[model samples]
Target: MSITLSHQDKITLHTAAHGAVSLMVAADATGRPHRAATDGSIALGSATGLVGHVLAEKIKDINLDGKSVAELADHVLPALTAAMSLLKQQAPAEAANFRSTVIVAIEAAARTHQAQPRPTVTDMIRKITAALDAA
Candidate 1:
């Protein structure tokens, strides 16, 4: 049977991953001139934090019996999808760019987490950023 982490441990893990994601996003969110590798770090950082907050509120219900990576995606994907939809409705232009990047990042993260034998917060963020860079 899979060992369950204490609530605090789970929070710590989420926080670490979220922090990494935020930094990555902010590095590329400079807008207009689009600093690319730099501006997104801030935006990513904020987005991860927002996702973490949502996850924090729903932590107890997150099923961990399956893969931990899938569990993480389950916690964060819906929020990301909703955010993307909301952005699309409120800011079509921004959404065009954000949607692809966010979706790419999340998918890459999920893939990386699934493939890795021992996934870490840094690993997930790096994979996501690498995917974003490739895109």
Candidate 2:
């Protein structure tokens, strides 16, 4: 079945991706460095923790509109990679952490997106008819 995203849904996805990347950049700017014997050196910040969580949750709800997992990954990978690159320049340790976190989050979102039930043709027709009748 063919699937489509409303303009608003497209905007939401775009905004969410941008916001997540922006947050990561902000985190890199503000993150604190720590040196530990066991853990070595790492950077930590609220923004760092928040970026992955927010992106994962926001991306999870995005309407893939019948796209395959690969398609979804293709769509999001660029943004994630760009963010990773930015983080790498500012904070190498944090970049590594962000890379792993983003990968896991994206994979989880892909699974969640795939698991969601798609609207059947009949469901679509009914909704369209209801809208027409209301109008």
Candidate 3:
């Protein structure tokens, strides 16, 4: 089945994905784990004024079929590209890091899942952050 997301959905997802990378950077800067930072950040609603609500809602609305991770990446490429452009301008290093982290995460997730259950945004974030930390 073909998957579709609205422009707002894409933007929200992009923000959340970027936020995940930002979270990793914050954790690295503070010498903490991504999970810890995620907890503290959520408790403080650090992203509340930015894209929290939209991210949560859009995540809930997403439903993935039996698509490959590469396909999934392709589906979101446009949104990712747009976000990367802005990120590159604001924080080039973080943008490069986010790009690498996301690509690796997608490939690993696809390998791990194969064609079983579809992946969720939360799952993707968890995997991505874990992979980032391990690397």
For candidate 1, lDDT tens digit of each residue in 2-120? 23345654443333334334433332233221233233333433443334333335455333232445554454434344444444444454445554445444433333223432334
Per-residue error for 96 in candidate 3, Å, reads 0.8
Tens digits of per-residue lDDT, candidate 3, 13-121, equal: 4543544434333323423345434543343243332233433343443322214554443344344555455545555555565555454433332333335423353
Better of 1 and 2 by lDDT: 1
Q: What C-alpha root-mean-square deviation, in Å, does candidate 3 show against the real structure? A: 13.1
| Candidate 1 vs. true structure, TM-score | 0.31
- TM-score, candidate 2, is 0.30
Name the candidate that leads on TM-score.
3
Instruction: Report lDDT (CA) for all predictions.
Output: 0.40, 0.34, 0.43
Model 1: residues with Cα > 4 Å off, grouped in runs: 1-67, 103-135
Worst 10 residues of 3 by lDDT: 105-114
**Candidate order, TM-score descending:** 3, 1, 2
**lDDT per residue, candidate 2, 17-132, as tens digits?**
43333222222222221111111111112224434343344344443331443344344444444445444554555556655543333222222223432333223223322322
Per-model TM-score versus the true fold = 0.31, 0.30, 0.34
Clashing pairs in 2: none
Order of candidates by lDDT, top first? Answer: 3, 1, 2
